[model samples]
Target chain A: MTAAPTIFLPEVPDGDDVGLAPSISRFELERFICGELPPERRAVIDRALAADPALKALHDDVVAADRAFLIEQPPLPFFQRPAKAPSWWAGLLSHWHAGLGAAAAAAAVVVVVVVATPDESNRTKGGVEGPRVSFFVKEESAARLGHAGEELKAGDQIQLAVKDVDKKALVVVGVDGAGSVTVYASESVQGGLSKGAGSPRVLPASLVLDETTGPERFFVVYGDDVDTLLQAVDSAARHLGDDVKAGRADLARTDQLPLGAAFPQSSVHIVKIR
Target chain B: MSISQMKDQELLTGLYRTHGGRVYARCFYLLRNKEEAQDALHEVFIKVHKNLAGFRNEASPLTWMTRIATNHCLNVLRAKRAPWHEKYKQEVDVGVAASVAGGGGAGFSLLENRELLRLCLAKVATTDGSLAELATYAFVDDMKQADICVLVGMSAPTLRKRLREFITICRAEIEAHVPGVVFAPAPI
Candidate 1:
């Protein structure tokens, strides 16, 4: 079968008559649906929708499309699927930067990739390890420090800031969730960060969380060489849950991390979801 | 009770209750296949379970999930191109041919019609640079212009201009692919 013909866009003329309905642009309608329009403009579209059944039908169609587009797939048992990031998720983050110029600047930052040893003598009440690496999540606007077990709500813009991180170290970040493990960011995988790049700093971009975002433990693996460190990251990325379930994945374990090994040096930071 | 205090299963149940329908719909439309869509939905819920606690509430949960589902499905499509999409395409083609015949693809469910619609929307990416991303946000994701602006880091005027161009191109493409399908919203 022949491939469908590609649609080529014509050069859009300035003030081109794009055949929109009178007094209502497509932008206005979309914004109206999202409740982003001003009250006066919203009232104008409201009158338009009320006056014209065709316009109302169009409105209904968009809503219907939105609904139709959201067909949920059936659920499966969590253990049925591997606990690794789907192959596509790696490219998923790159999609956000495809046409989004400078939007990366707005993304949440990873201030430090802390790798610490677990000390049973210093274990906390909730099974949290005594934080080997000191990290802070400070609300950008309020400058309020987020404690290790503090609750953060939606709309909270935080910077994951770290102090005294190794300048030559590579940072690997991975999330161990209820069902799957995903490596959302890695300084080594992404590209090695210089000392300045790896310095203690608040993620310049704001952090946003959601309701299904459960308590997460971010594992920050530090290494001297990007490639050498990432070998362990790749191993971790591939076997995030396998080793974790056996408790063998713990970086603090002497077996997991032989002291002075180029790889296996990392810290785990756990954030409580409230 | 605090949301944080809820069990993992309970938290997922609540999220599924609130956004499940939309998340499922978005997955089905993008994947255009029942089984894969179902798989995508489960993956989305898992990600939600992992990420929801840190949700910043800037956008509604529905919006957040829709964004998640969109990217997830796109990834699914991108990974296995040959057999998966080819089979899906043939199915959609048969459905379209049936629709043209007068039954309006009665054999193909209404869900198929919407799936076919998204299939055409996905084609908008093939046209040229930037249009694919723009089309995804505007038509597939139904994002607001203001949010699109922040997302793409384009000025309002640039965003509007490109979107208008996008509308014109997508309408022509969708119409060509699915004759008489009124899936494209009327502009203005």
Candidate 2:
């Protein structure tokens, strides 16, 4: 009636040629799986995997082992994940890094942490406040001029400029991450994409030009037209149920509204540096 | 999907739909017991939904969740050692032994082979130098490499070296303990 002795052991395989264990890391393996590694490395590994059955078997085991570990592990909490962008991700913005694992996928959630952790002012993701726009013009005083633009009511006349027109420009306005409103514009607006019908089409007015705009020198008309454009922008932008609270719709100004440059007047461009 | 195409709400919905189950399943694997996994999964999802706004293209969501799940399961495991895992281990062994002993009955059919395979695996699992607890956590639960890497911080090279040694230990222990059960020793 003695209690059975505990534990069972298996027979060791007959060969001693298992070789030194692989040196690749779980991260590198992930990069490999993600196709993040260079083509050469992938080619080499693919060849290796195809050539040796044992190696291929080990590779499958390795992948399976990873999968099993993932299955057993709880989905890690994404809320309080890392803040700074991983170097690899920040480096390659074009590539959509996806399905890597809970760790790599968790990158989406950590993004929240990173964005919030900044803005020393502890800005909450509160409801939309009114648009607070700032026009980073080529001049210094113009920077502060935007404060006035926010207070501009309808019928107020102001002059602004026409920035580069891309097929579909990525504009940044009121908000940073959430403010890219691609507006299709008229043919007259430099590189305007879509326009016609004997007259020009109204651009999605609030469009913010990219850095390559070079602070292009031109003028814009602000009055009933500007107000109408702004309203249209606000409406179209929030159409997707965003209720976008524009910070400030900055309209770049140069001088009195243009009264047709060809009116027997001048080609002389003058900034009243008063 | 294009960023412009999916509205925020749609994106949020997609996040839940795609990742919810696997995440929960993983929790179950970590806990190895049912309720604990469920609880952990609930907590993570709630946190994710609440904090979706702050995402700023930082660390990927996968990394984020692994850290959370890793911390959560580890917390649960550390909190109560013998409760969940021990009970599970006992039940599994008993179930296997009974089925094998049962007169080649219904439950003994498919599970029979699976049980044998699992028992063999368990035996193999023991040979690693890891304590029964550490070994319990290192299961192959169908995670991607990144996820597994997060769970086990030690690099692949390190794991390879240690796993071989650990497997050897388990094999020796099994051979010494189980009188005549001849089985192939897993790689050490």
Candidate 3:
């Protein structure tokens, strides 16, 4: 009988224990576990969990915790609901404070003009020459938007383009009309846009103004702090009344507020849809 | 006031009607305790009302509300206790070691996969930082291999090798907890 040849395989390398990648943030993990990731991204996590026992186990626990809470809690009562800013009527204060010289600027230029360069102090100490922000409206068959306010009608598609947001800032966006104000985008610049790294930031979804839509005011505030801007909007909305109009001056007015102290270099653009 | 803004309060009321139940459920789930969850319900709804205008409907309203609820609860928990990362990691390490030592083979309900999975990942994170990083990026962050490699600073061959090792460990753990649940051998 021939002796069987013996083959030896070396022990599998356990791999070097370098620290985690900076890009894989704790927030990202929470979002994944909570099912907040889009389908394509979610699949990536699903595959990894499937192949890795430890990750699968961790995912299981997160799922379990979520399930436990869902199972144990009772429905909340209506009266228990917290106070919120009214949605429909454009607050007069918000309309009044919509921009710096908003009323005047809005009256002067019926068309929206995007300011490419922000105030020097507002610019990062040595940041890349800021991102160019433009508004586009889908009119007729083509998406035509030369400036901020260029005649928008019912069912018109509204989109915003932010160029060169090299990942240093955040973008907060909202639409305030006589009826209601809607925040379209607010988050880190990376999340607000749909393009790849180094691409111009564009709103992920195209907003279509419905039939009831009237003189909708769009404001794009570019800076570092989203929460602060949100608070400012809240404060402005609270004191506002129904008569406040959407003017370019209201948009410019934001740059002069104490809130602008934190976002000195921030660009606030307002567009009115009629 | 414009028509839409006029309906803002009504819109919020409508939102409560549609999503209040699920929001409370999510708050309780993360908070674990009832009282904390209840407080979170009010805080979360207020946040919802303020941000309601910004919601672009890119995601379902329920999903948005759930996120808000979860964030509120997480913040509350963070404020009340020690850092979750350190606490969870320390506890997870000990549990993972015990499980791997051939002692955790008792019958666990297949339905308890979520709890088991959480326990197992904590252990994995402690034992192998590289593996843990890979698992987090791949499973938690859901980054593609190319992106992960760039982020982790690993070559394709090295990443592939590390991934294989991670899978083997994970599979073993699964088999230990629930026999035949993963990678069952084919019949002869």
- Candidate number with greatest DockQ: 2
**Residues forming the 10-long window of minimal summed lDDT in candidate 1 chain A:** A117-126
TM-score of 1: 0.38
Q: In candidate 1, what are the lDDT values of residues A1-274, reduced to their tens digit? A: 2323222232333442221356564544645665546789788888889898877886787666545433212121121112243321233223222311222223322222222312212112112321122234434322434444345554343434433234344443444444245433333223323343423343222334433344444445556655455556656554655555565554223212222333434344344354
Which has the greatest TM-score? Answer: 1
lDDT of 1 at A175: 43
Give the per-residue lDDT digits (tens) of candidate 3, residues B5-29: 4245445544654555556655654
Deviation in Å, model 2, residue B162 alpha carbon:
3.9
lDDT of 3 at B30: 47
| Residue-by-residue lDDT tens digits, candidate 2, A36-104 | 467887786677567667656756665565565444331321221012312111211111112123222
Give the alpha carbon lDDT tens digit for every residue of B1-188 in model 2.
12222233334434433454445544665566655665676676556656666643524554455456655665665555445445645655565455435532222222123333333334433332133223332323222333344556755455445444544554454344334434432324
lDDT of 2 at B141: 27
Give every prediction's interface RMSD: 14.4, 12.7, 16.8
Per-residue lDDT of candidate 3, residues A1-274 (tens digit):
2221111111223433221232333334445665557888777666766776766665676566556543333122122111243322223223222221322233222223223222122212224543445555544444444443345554444455555444434433343444234444444454534354334434433444434443434444445545555556444443331324444334323332233434423233334344
lDDT-best of 1 and 3: 1
Model 1 bad stretches (over 4 Å): A1-274, B1-11, B91-117, B124-133, B151-153, B157-188
Query: Candidate 1: fnat, from 0 to 1?
Result: 0.02
